[model samples]
Target: MITIEQYVGKWSENEDWTEVRQAYAAQLLIQVNKLLEAAKKAGIELKNNPNTDSLISGTQYGGFRPQSCPIGAAGSSHKQGQAVDIFDPQNKLDGWINDAILTQYGLYREHPDATIRWCHLSTRAPKSGRRTFLP
Candidate 1:
């Protein structure tokens, strides 16, 4: 099992995203590590080393830009450094994984009804509680 520190170290070593070594990135790294552990326990193989194409770089703070939607514009979460679009290796299993598993780790899929099919997960929570795009 990889510790969060180790995961963060590996992530920092990625030349493509070296800027993510900041404090905020470290926090996200810890959260992702926890998720990875849970996923491993559930027999799921998450692709941590996704291709560059799978990632959508954001202009705000190197977070991720959401695909354009009728509800709003792109790059919203980018500003807050709180959103990411995960690319699933198996398209068929993506929806189920996003809905059933990721939510347990403080992630929520956004804009399911939109044309683009990307899983949006964030650590952000509202005053009320954790929000879900589905139901």
Candidate 2:
């Protein structure tokens, strides 16, 4: 689990979000933990090397992205603190894992296209019963 400070540090540097940061951070962390737990149960190992900018480091873990970020998609769940991009530069996600296991953990990969290798998991609400694309 990452600290709220770690969660909001990058964003806070650009603006004063003291009061609202905790709420977003908490929601993000909850989902992150849930995913981690599910990975454990599914016998999947997450990227853990210190050099990797991953959820384990809370650095470039692909959590909230400021609207200014070039990669931030319009109306993206990432802007709402309800999404994360999971990727390991050295290895792809375990091939044994499937969509069913991710859904069971309250996470849905926003994109399933084979070319889009990274896992974009989100907790966006009012789900449109849609599961194959990022907003």
Candidate 3:
């Protein structure tokens, strides 16, 4: 099981987030840990947490951006404690692990082709299994 301390350790590395945001991020991490453990039990290897330095330096902003917006723009989910960008330099795997697999565990998001790709996972429970950029 992932502890709160481990979650905080991972969250605190991101310099872009303020103390208040970091607290929210830590809570999100806890949810992520539960999802990750579920994925692991099913024989999946989720990517490692992206380096915070890389995430902070790679983009000027962070959050949910509309599909029409340019790449690297901020998106709203980041501010609401429901999403995170998993940076994988090689692009070896789809930003999201198999949606089918994730769906079984109640996680969902959309992936678009852009300069920088990051896996966006949400902790929010939707009424139906659908992708909503604003949610």
**Prediction-by-prediction clash tally:** 0, 0, 5
Q: What TM-score would you give candidate 2 relative to the actual structure?
A: 0.66
Identify the superior model by TM-score, candidate 2 or candidate 3. Answer: 2
TM-score of each: 0.49, 0.66, 0.47
**Cα RMSDs of all predictions?**
7.4, 3.7, 6.8
Between candidates 1 and 3, name the one with more favorable TM-score: 1
Q: What is the lDDT of residue 115 in candidate 3?
A: 22
The whole-model lDDT of each prediction reads 0.44, 0.56, 0.48
Q: Candidate 1 vs candidate 2: which has greater lDDT? A: 2
Candidate 3 residue spans exceeding 4 A from truth: 1-27, 34-75, 93-96, 112-115, 125-135
Query: Per-residue CA lDDT of candidate 2, range 1-135, in tens?
Result: 444555554676655343464476577678667767667676666765353344533345466666666666655666656666555333345353466756666655555453244566666543666544444
